[model samples]
Structures are given as C-alpha cells and as structure tokens.
Target: MTSTLILGGRRSGKSARAQALASTFAEVTLIATATASDGEMAERITRHQADRPAHWHTVESPLYLASALQQADAAGCCLLVDCLTLWQTNLLLAEDETLLARETDALLAILPRLQAEVILVSNEVGWSIVPESALARRFADEVGRLHQRLAAACQRVELVVAGLPLTMKNETGTR
Candidate 1:
C-alpha cells in the first residue's frame, strides 16, 4: 500500500498521530531527520527519542533521506519520518542545494516502488505570517513547497489541529 502524509503545526499532535498509525505495522522504523547541532536541538532530540516506544528501530539521517527510505524499504519495515521541517532546515543550511533537490526527487520517485507502509510528518508552515529574515523566509517557502509535493504523493493526507485529526485525503486502512 502507498504511504500517508500527516501535516500540522508545531506540537499539533502530528507526530503522535503518525506514531499511532505506525504502531499498526509489525515492524516500525523511525527515520529521524533532526540533527543535534546545538544544546537546544540536542535536548529536543533527546525528548523525542524518549517519547518513542523502546522497541521501534530508529535511524538518524539529517541528509540523504531518500537513501534512508530505500534502506527501510529493503528491510520490509514500516517507516515513520517524524518531521520534514527539520530535514528542510538541514538542507537549507547545506552548501549544496542541488543535493537537496536531487534527494527530494529521488524520495518522491521511490515511494511508489517501496513495499513497506510509510508515514511522513511535516509542519504546516504556510499558515503563519511571513518570516522577517531572508533565510527564514526562504526556509519557509522551501518547506511549504516540499509539504505540498509530499501531500500529493501520499495515498492519504491528514491535517491535525488542537491535537485532533481531520482527514484531507482519506484512503482505506488509514483510520
């Protein structure tokens, strides 16, 4: 079956919902896109790691997410990418934007061929006001565009608000 996309604002319960959905699968693999570059980020990553079930396998990939997905697919594992926003941040900061674009394209192209269930979680950044700084604005735009593309790629799409989920694109076995 094809994967699903869960989009929501920060702390809007998107990750929680994704985790719940992932639990249905026999083998769950978490693809972590966050990198610990600073103390705050490290703490955040720690908290996220603590929140997840101990049995779920975790793979840290701040870049080359498409390759990680392929690995998960090869293992016949259900995959949950907790947040795309952080991955976007990592890409934007990278010196090579071309690599980011290539990786994203590869990810989109490979998703349909994969056998495992996949759940992609991303922030709804377009709902907020325009960012003040140029870098922030660019990051927002990139993330928003990525979210749009992934949402279309998925078989099911859901928007979470106030910890409640509203299905945007409903599909069988998604409830």
Candidate 2:
C-alpha cells in the first residue's frame, strides 16, 4: 500500500490533484469530511459532488475517519480523503473533549497499515496570520504537528500552490 499526503492553500487545486491521482485506479472511494453548515458551503459541497465520477463511492466521514477508512480499504483499491482540515474542525467543535486526541491517534496508527492506495488532502494553514482566538491558535499548532507525523508515514508528499503541485517527497515502489 502507498499513502500520499497532499497539502495546499485554499483553492490551490490540491483536492483536484488528489482526485486526478485517484482516477488512475479502477476502484475508488472518496471520504468527504466537510459538512454543509451554511447555504454557501452546501453549494460548494454540491459542486464538488458534481465533479466526481458517479460510480466512485463516497463515504461521509466526519469524526470516525479511521473506522471509515478501515471499512473502505481494499487491496488494489484507491481511497481519497478530500481534506483533513474540516475533520479537525469537526473534532474541535464537538462536545466530546477527547475526540480529537482519540481520533488523531487512531488515524495515525492506521494509515501505514491500510491496504489501499490512500491519498489525503489537507490545507497548509500555518502560512496565514496568527489567529486571534486561542482555539484557532491551538488548531494551527495541532494541525502543523499532525502534518509532520503524516509526512513521515506517507510514502509521497506534495504541496500544491497556484494550481500546481510540487513534489515534496516520493517513495513510491520503494516498499
């Protein structure tokens, strides 16, 4: 199994790049984490849905991402997770105080063992100005650290900007 991590700023085409890569596989399952909390977001989600192939399976994974991945994984299949930042947001806003730590640990533990070709998309949010709220700052810190760990686990890592993807590390076919 090969795992890839794709990071980029908003609208930088990281999700599109992930989608294109996953398209190489015959079987694909997309794990969508964002929730349509507002009308604008609902429209964005709809547009994304319209972009994907109808036959490609999609799993709405808000909190239990590891479990969702585990259930969807299959040898020779491709699993595309279209943004970890929203997943982080969901955990942070949830009532369960320990949800973030628990799920984070679970995902970290499971990534390397998954049998499918896994592509994870996340925003590189540390580039922006420091957030005003303590919660936002905490999120920045936590996500930055999580990116580091994910990079180590992933065989390939990419950074997309201005609709271009720059390979950060690639270890495909090495294992």
lDDT for model 2: 0.94
List the candidates' TM-scores in order.
0.94, 0.97
Per-residue C-alpha lDDT of model 2 across residues 19-57, encoded as one tens digit per residue: 999999999999999999999999999999999899999
lDDT of 1 by residue, 45-129 (tens): 8988888889999999888888898887744568899788888888888999687788788889988888888899999998889
| C-alpha lDDT of all candidate models, in order | 0.86, 0.94
lDDT: which candidate is best?
A: 2
What CA root-mean-square deviation does each model show from the true structure? 1.5, 1.4
Error of 1 at 74 (Å): 4.7
Positional deviation of residue 101's Cα in model 2 after best superposition, in angstroms: 0.7
lDDT of 1: 0.86
Best by TM-score: 2
**Residue pairs in clash, model 2:** none
Candidate 2: count of backbone clashes, pairs at least 3 residues apart or interchain:
0
